[model samples]
Target: MATNQNFIGGFQVNRHLLIAGAALTGAGALIGLTGTVIVGAALASAGRGWVRQLDTPPSELATRKLHQARAASLAGLEAWRTGTDGSPN
Candidate 1:
């Protein structure tokens, strides 16, 4: 869907987190370490949260508009990526 393509922000943060969590979770299970499992679960939860924030509708975090320069830069980058003239993207 076009919505999927439009709502983009996080590129790698969520993925590395998820991979680390899954690996840790499996290792913890093999080693019978409850604490390791807890940490891994926490990381996985954080990764999923990141996914929800990045991929959901309105695709923006609470602080997305906090910095004018950063926002403008991101808008510019998106405009270039989409091959536009940066018309209020």
Candidate 2:
């Protein structure tokens, strides 16, 4: 009778330990996922700021170069339409 009681007690203790371990594992996984999501969001925000800076055109040199390239392309296209190589006016 005493041995039977001891066996039952041991079984219950083992069950409780298993449940606690599973809960801890689930909590750790949740924490890792949360950290990953936060890091990804921070990187995405920084990338957006970098892209915005590139698009803002804050320098005269950059604007001038862009205009020059556009003009050259337009001149080339016009020459092609008129069936001649572009030459200086």
Candidate 3:
């Protein structure tokens, strides 16, 4: 099934339904039909998909790698400060 990668108000949605709703809304405007606009809005709203899981905790190796990255980042920052600003902390 096709799904939207972009978030709509912090939640994902059905891209197809959203596009259909937009088309319908544009058609409604052109034809001057309030019912069409309402239907379009309903379709667009029905497309919304609520977020369930944001992220999962890293595994052991992944956690180790994350720590390594953090250490490297700090070391690089310290080196830059010492060399450029002559400040060591």
Please list all clashing residue pairs in model 3, or write none if there are none. Answer: none
Output the worst ten-in-a-row residue range by lDDT, candidate 2.
Answer: 1-10
Q: lDDT per prediction?
A: 0.71, 0.80, 0.74
Candidate 2 local lDDT, residue 47: 82
Error of 1 at 6 (Å): 75
TM-score of each: 0.27, 0.48, 0.29
Candidate 1 structure quality by residue, lDDT tens digits, 33-80: 877788999999998887777654343543565576688888989989
Query: What is the overall TM-score of model 3 with all chains considered together?
Result: 0.29
What are the RMSDs of all candidates, in order? 25.0, 8.7, 21.2
lDDT of 3 by residue, 1-89 (tens): 45766565767778889899999999878787777888998877665422222253346558989899999899889979878655765
> Can you tell me which runs of candidate 3 are displaced by over 4 Å?
6-10, 33-89
> Under the 3 Å rule for N, CA and C atoms, how many clashes does model 2 have?
0
The clash numbers for all candidates, in the given order, read 0, 0, 0
- Per residue, candidate 2 scores C-alpha lDDT tens digits across 1-89 of 32232354455245566678999999999999999999999999998888677845457668998899999999989989998864666
Candidates 2 and 3, the one with greater lDDT: 2
Backbone clashes in candidate 3 total 0
